[model samples]
Target: MQINGKTAISYHYFQRIKESLTFAATVAALLLTQLRVALIMSLVRYFKLINIFQVLFKLFTIEFGIDSSGSALDLANENIVLNELNQGKVSFVKGDATTFMKGAISENELWDLVILDPPKLAPRKKVLQSASGMYRSLNALAMQVVKPGGLLMTCSCSGAMTQSGMFLKTIQGAASMAGRKVTVLRQAGAACDHPIDPAYPEGQYLSNYLLRVA
Candidate 1:
């Protein structure tokens, strides 16, 4: 309908308001949906049900010392073997691994056994290259600090890289850079607590290797 100037202006104003309200509502709905999905995923992860078998395997099989600033008793309860180690021979350094390794320990000081258990280097596909570089640097540092005839236990939880490929490359690269030769002793993974479904190899993420510095 043809309207007078004032009437047409009022009608256009209302149309603009309606369009703005629709856009705001659409954005709110998208935000709410994203929040809900994040909440659900967090809950699943918290309960460990999304990967229950894998969790169980990791808890059961891995034999490593727990490192915490607090008393080992506090963290050891999570693993029976670690608990025993805490009470017995395993050493717990209450410091960051990289810093601890770099600190005042004499160049002559030698660690017969060094365990490099860093967290997941990369969780996303896009960051794999950067993560690998980080991993290589970590290994290089560890190798420099490890004594001849000492054992280096290094690992990666980045599923983007294959276990065999990443582990071998990391050790070899580190050894080459450090001007040392390494002999692989053993390879390990998550324990019975974190069982991996044969069909779902992605669930099998932890990779460990024991190598002797030569």
Candidate 2:
């Protein structure tokens, strides 16, 4: 075959075009196969076939128990508090500590025990100052509701707020605002199930303190 120069160039161009088309088709086919596999896996999981093992593992491996808060019960539990008060143990109030101290309850109406488990005041370091203000305000109000010899259980779950720093500042701020003296009774942390990994101190989120407001 006698091929001219222009004809040879045309043949080379056609070959390159064919190779490009073949590569594109291969990539498209691979993607479609992956999508089909993903769809099948999703359907299996949705139908509970793949989740059956997880369900069985949880059912057989997990054990549950009811924690008994003996004679010295948590006054926050409505049923327990009502039951105790009915049995002539102690009285209780169902209200927010912050609002309750701010004249929500009469001055004569005082509580023997108070629990301040407010929500997370600061989720990040940037909001720590604002969160501290909220904590101080709340504690100030709480101080008014507690009797002279009453017990106060104040707590915070803000990881950004250190335990010693936030707790001491809260007591100081509340005392300064309400013009009351607070005595520290005890300090505590989370229960067993919520263990704090030494490597990850952020895992320890809860800080609880028992104080006497006078």
Candidate 3:
């Protein structure tokens, strides 16, 4: 599927998340009447994403899909109408992820879950250092906005960042910066369908981690 004019190569992660979301939704259903989720730099179809979460949870969900691009938000809205999903469940916010997180923190806003899927910050190894800083800063802000003991799903699509074997360390750094304690619940790469060749490590460009923040 094409998302925002690009082929959805990482769609597999969405499927993997669906499985986890089912379990999360089940837990939420037992404890709450609704689920609040925030997707930073989602850059995809909001309705499809919202539908997936709602269908799994079988409860009202409020999703804030934050992206900087107005066009992406437009496409997300278009997708909602195209898919016939409930429009009221999703809110598209146009803003930078870091800025949004800062605002949320100032307002003491929090969510049950937060998904940080920013665009590749470092396309080449040479820029990895600067990219790591950017990643850490953004993630620290994200951590502060997640409710204590809430779930956080973060991803780095930069091959350089993933291959450096520093993503987990980066998250630890972020936790420290945010004054939050985070425990890794799961760590994974691209889904099974997105095979990675041993000789071509770049094929393993995606690193995903699920954590519990306190």
Candidate 4:
């Protein structure tokens, strides 16, 4: 993998990928992070790179050599920041997840791999309802563009939604509504570094699921 500079992916995220994906495949990320970008680079060295919708143009510009071909969806108007940085390599779509997904689906643009690792949707119990709605909407739109029988992996940072609880159930609901079937492949929780104390059950806050979509 050709890294632009000296950015290293977290060991925790790097080792979670168990599938062997073909290089030069079309990849999309809903919520982009350094770790996810690193993983993408590692898998497909350099062939048709597409970024997620977020506030990370400069990072990807350096990593993927983003140009007109590689695009990122920035819902929170992060493109402004990228503009200020003078990073024009990436095409930043200015809209929310729903908007970007709509365009992708209408255009029949499908991806081979999809990665999702958004920020905390439900930070407090009181907002779980709203957060759940957002998650469902995001996943539903993302599902529509995933190539048939492809892979879709998402992460939930809220401890309230664990593998056996609300999170996977939420993704399942989205898949069902989108007319997509999901086969549970592997589910991951906290890394070794993040310990869950018996007294503090909420210490394990990261829930990642790798699903085979049909």
Candidate topping lDDT: 3
TM-score of each: 0.57, 0.54, 0.80, 0.58
User: Cα miss at 184, model 3 (Å)?
Assistant: 0.7
Task: Highest TM-score: give the candidate number.
Answer: 3
lDDT of 4 by residue, 1-214 (tens): 1121111222212322432222213243322232223122112222222232222343333222211222332321254454354444433332344555587689986654455555577877778778888888777776776666555666677766662378877998899888988877667775555678889877777777776567
> Which residue segments of model 2 deviate by more than 4 Å?
1-97
TM-score of model 1 relative to the true fold?
Answer: 0.57
**Of 2 and 4, which scores higher on lDDT?**
4
What are the Cα lDDT values of the candidates?
A: 0.48, 0.48, 0.72, 0.51
* RMSD of candidate 4 to true structure, Å: 10.0
Model 2 clashing residue pairs (backbone):
none
Per-residue alpha-carbon lDDT of candidate 1 for residues 101-197, written as tens digits (9 for 90 to 100)? 4552445434433556566667876887788887787777676655564456666767765533566786688788778788876666765667899
Predicted structure 4, TM vs. truth: 0.58
Across residues 122-213, which tens digit of lDDT does each residue of candidate 2 receive? Answer: 88878988888888887777666665645556667788776436767767898889787897766666656578889998887777666767
Candidate 2, poorest ten consecutive residues by summed lDDT = 35-44
Backbone clashes in candidate 4 total 1
Off by over 4 Å in 3: 1-31, 43-57
